[model samples]
Target chain A: MQLVDKDQVSKSLGGRLIRNNIMKFLFLLCTLVGLVVLVTLIVDTVLDGWNYLTWDFLTSFSSSRPENAGVYGAIIGSIWLMAVTAPVSIILSVGTAMYLEEYAPENRLTDFIKINISNLAGVPSVVFGLLGLTIFVRQLALGNSVLAAGLTLSLMILPVIVVSSQEAIRSVPSTVREASVGMGATKWQTVSRIILPAAIPGIITGIILALSRAIGETAPLVVLGVPVSLLVTPNSALDTFQALPMQIYNWVKMPQEEFQYLTAAGIIILLIILFLMNSVAIYIRNKFSKRY
Target chain B: MTDSQLKEDKNMGTEMGTEIGTEVKQADNASGIIESGQPVFQAKDFNLWYADNHALQNINLTFSENEISAIIGPSGCGKSTFIKALNRMVELVPIVRTEGHILYRGDNIFDKKMTVEELRTKVGMVFQNPNPFPKSIYDNVAYGARVHGIKKKKILDQIVEKSLRGAAIWDEVKDRLNQNAYGLSGGQQQRVCIARALAIEPDVILMDEPTSALDPISTTKIEDLIQQLSKDYSIVVVTHNMQQAARVSDKTAFFYQGYVVEHDDTSAIFENPKDKRTEDYVSGRFG
Candidate 1:
């Protein structure tokens, strides 16, 4: 070979080095920006409400006057909403996921259903609220009660549950299915005994995350006509409810400075509850993951 | 030749079945005095297709009770498909189509009156890789029993212990019964799978390369377990490892390109093969 050009090789190597450096710089910049934004949001929330967070603020109920406002009713309402919504959403989501992943044939109709589910997942929360109002409250004649709100929330979170449960069910190795079938287990037996147990942790984690979203939602609840203030805890599904976010929205909109402080207190409490739920979900995931 | 080489040649001979006819002739002479009963399972003119691609072509075989029958073949020879068809496991695939009858104790398993679930309970299976359920070790072994309606705790406990013992894994895993099954080693998991199958109290146990995923030691252990298991239950094992077949099985069937080229007593098939294709396959000339 006519003496390989050393100069060209060196030049190309230098160019490659420069390009690599620029690519690394861009990656670092993006990561730093993301971390800064996340930290800023957390810090702002903490600084705004640090002083207002107290035990009495947490334990007391709501009041008509902004000065005496507490989150007891709102907290209870959130708890009740979660208790009702989570089970319904989970059952519907997991069932849908199982039917789609395991039983449903690969056809145009099923494919269409799957595509619509993903699209529904992207639909705005307010749209879900509107759907709930029309379907559950008006058409179903359930009224603007906790039951209606819960049903609405259940529908709102259904897509999340389905997607997560599908992923969980899908993650179970094909070898497991083959082994079960090889062992002479019926399809249903294999699903219930093997696939479901392996996927339970993932389903639970999805439910927790979806419930967190449901807890913080305000636009949908507003559309459901959940009351801004409620003195008594809801005793039945038909009773009007006030969620933490709605209560905070009511408190923050008040002209009084004390109410703004109370709003911060409410925000802190909601964050703590969400944090606890997330932690429990993480714990369950870790525990089951080890077993799997 | 070394012991290993001798063992290899013996395996190669079994796979080829060049001497199977002679071996069967000798066996006939020796066993002419003894009376044999009906086979546990009889498949007559069994044919299977996967959407027009014939997977199994005119397979006819019968498996005896309390005997180990080994199916040896190169990859994609329809050995697995044939075994799956016995218990209606292949029906799960929408594309799979079958013709002919698989009779189990005088009743056609494919009859409309017979359910796939009922057939499966009678014919349990173990797989190539160990697949324990994501449950406690005790629960993993107890699952089959529980499914068949053994609800009492003490009864389930006894079944679990007995099945584990049957699979030769009870002593190793007895203390850690409550531990998650995933924590067990690969060999233990495979044994646990065997125990799970045993807990169902099936009449026949189907094994598809049950030791292919394990180390040599584990393979030996599983082979021993299989030999022991055949004393009580009919076993039909599919193995790519020729030595494994000679080591454990009483009868050997050599399959080539989806056809059973030769089948006879293990000693005869190994000592003198009857088919050139099987001989070539056993000699590592071609799959």
Candidate 2:
């Protein structure tokens, strides 16, 4: 055999080495950035408010004086908003998902609807707030109350809920449908009994995640003119409301150091609530997935 | 063996012809023993199409009340299509169309008076793969009964137990009725599907390669169960396994390229086939 050339071997080896080095560097850079962001958020939040996060701060009602103020009203408002939004959003979203995933035929109109839904998911939260201000708040005559805010947020998160629920319903095997239909069950019966039950875990997880996002939203509520402070909780749809994000917003704008501290404490509570919701969603997904 | 036996055999042949054209079979015992009366279904000049492709061509056959009739053919031979047509199941496919007369208990099943749902209740079908719903075993069997409006707990429990026993899986799954059916073995799941079908108490049961997805032992168990089940319900099975067809069926219909090459008693079809193609296929000459 002829002797191999040194230059050719070196060139091939060098090319491979350079390519691998570039890939490794890119991967490491991405990992570093991700880790840095995660650590920074956690460390900054802890350092900013850990000492002030107490039961008294959590349970006490809000006050005009920075030293005495708490997040009770905002917490209650957030709870009420979620309670109202969850059921309404789930009903509308799951129903739409079922119709689209199961019954809707392939057509241009459906395709248009699907594309618009994805676009709506990407639409800015503030834009939704603007729309709510003009439509639900003014035209529809619903004032800056929990009902108006809840409805606005429901529309904002509706796309996410529908998309996620559709994925869940679509994931159920077609064999299950055939089995039910072959057994002489009606279309409605099969959907309700077999398809709905199998898809419940997925739907619940999606609803929780979507609701968590809705709970954190502030711009739409502000645009809808939700109150900055309220001693008594709103009892009806027409009464004005103030939520967690609005409370945080209001406190952060104040010039006093005490109000700043209170805002940070509220931020901690908000993060904990989000973390809890995400964990519950993850648990449900794991539980249902194990059965399949 | 004897002169009297020879004469009886001749008489039986003539009697067989008159009975064959009329009554299909009725279940009697563990064997697929046909009682020469009571035809359950009759198909005359049946044809089917999936869009433009011709699937089944001029099929004429009869299924007895309590006998297992096996439809054996090569791939794409339309055995499954024919079975689906019997229950109007082919309608599920958007492009599927059929031109045929399938008479069930002397009623034209394709008539406006006969709804697909009503026809399905009288004739149940089991697919090739075992597909138990993502529910408890008891619920899997009880699903059909509940759809038909049986709600009392005691009544549902009785129906579930009876169906499981009929499908020959009661002894294995009875202790774990509350457990999810998806956790079971493939063979057990197939039996659960069979039990689900049986829960409706249909007059006829159609199985599409019910044992193809099973292990040898499981296949044997299902074969034995099929033989036992023929005592109460008529079974029309489509299988690729020749031995399964010969073992479980009293009558065998050999289909080739969407045509019925031969239809006769299982022994005759296997041992002394009237058609050369059937002889070649059964003797392993060609598919």
Candidate 3:
């Protein structure tokens, strides 16, 4: 009746305890690596850029003289690009996700599309820039304008937005849809009223995260050939633009050591944008999660 | 029964003893079958398949007006599937296919003219778990009306009040109508779901284990509510709990492996089921 004989030597609990402690310590060390790196980077940036991070630095235009250089034009250009990119990417991705989740029939074609979309999310951002060069910049003749850059960035992040939005849509319980349909709601009605509202928190969070990625991305804009040091802000989508990351990249490669301080300030600005975006996402998630 | 037929029944003004929860069995003693008058839904040799697997087999059952019909079976006995078939909701599954006819008000639901939306409008459903929309209690009840294009705020409020009252949770939720439905207890949420189904004014409501997830007190409240609602609305419920079927249903259908083993008055089904399987199931020897 005994599962284990009393004489049987149990797998050494003391050895297991030591193994567990070692594994826990290893994980703690791994976490500390990331934390230490992040804290050090932030501290270094602050120490290097504190003098350059002034109100005047934010308001003034970029200059050949590092002391007078500012990110005014880059900030406005980033904002303008986002105005187009955010709406375009959110609308297109949500629509694609809805179609794939709700309307698309279960078939080989749909399966192929799903797999392609997931794979596309992992594609290099530089490749999307190349695609933009061929399509938006040359074939469409949009030139090196904010419109072209926004479209290119939108394309680059579309797969990520789609994948996350699909996840959001999937999380809306099938029971909710069933209840809607059982009450005579049409397909569109169910999607718009029940599914969309329930999934909005998740969708918005995904969108904000995607926007953060798009905002920090330098390689794609570099390949798109956005101006790195424009003095004038882009007032229209058709106007030439420069982004914070592009400006930082230009400054980092410059000969003057002071430009490195400007580069650090630009990184700080980029981090601020990232923090604000993530904060908004967290707020939305918390407010809506309480309801459901 | 057609819409006009329903109107005629309404005109009868509850004169017949069968108008409410009072049992009026139309029994052929020789055949030992108790058929109620004025059938609301009639499934004739209905069969359903999910891909190659047959899920419901030759289902021939009639649900009469103003009565609660309970479908009792073990897990995976196709009871839920059968209830979903009433509103043509089973078609939502891509692999599902059906043969024969399910007649709702004397017309085959599979007919080209009878749209699924229309069928569902006449026959609403409440799921096992309370699935109120993540919205205000008022909005959750008003959702069905809004989906049917009733948008006036005044009308929506009125419908919401009437539906919550119909579900017998109006007093408890009246002050908190604007609050999120999810903030309410599980029982209250289920009542909200019931009120939501009531808002569309469906003649028949299909309930798939509506109280299975609730506490005993909530279950009792819902059972009492169901008994009262059956005075006006025909209800078809699927329950794993036999005692619930006994407490709430006027008629019971015993399902086993996708077949209706026995269908009769609740008393006969529980007291003296003809089928050996039904007897064993009712006696708790086996499902």
**Steric clash pairs (candidate 1):** B14-B270, B17-B273, B17-B274, B18-B272, B18-B273, B18-B274, B19-B272, B19-B273
- TM-score, model 1 to reference: 0.85
Candidate 2 deviant stretches above 4 angstroms? A1-29, A59-65, A106-108, A255-258, A287-290, B1-36, B272-277
- Return the TM-score for each candidate structure: 0.85, 0.85, 0.90
Model 3: what is its DockQ?
0.60
For residues B4-118, could you state the per-residue lDDT of candidate 3 as single tens digits? 9988887775454233323322221222333465989999999999999999999999999887899999899999999989998889899999999989989999999999999
Please list the C-alpha lDDT of all candidates, in the order they appear: 0.84, 0.86, 0.89
lDDT by residue for model 1 (A194-233), tens: 8988898998899899988999999899998888877788
lDDT of 1 by residue, B1-287 (tens): 69999999989876655354344445433532333345988888888999988988788888888778889999999998888787887876878989999899878999999887788888998887898877888988888877777799999999999999999999999999999889999999999999999998999999989999998688878987987897789899999987677767777888777778888777667667888877777667786
Docking class of 2: acceptable
A best-first ranking of the candidates according to their DockQ comes to 3, 2, 1
Task: Please say which candidate is ahead in TM-score: 1 or 3.
Answer: 3
Measured by lDDT, the strongest candidate is 3
Give the lDDT of residue A228 in candidate 2. Answer: 88
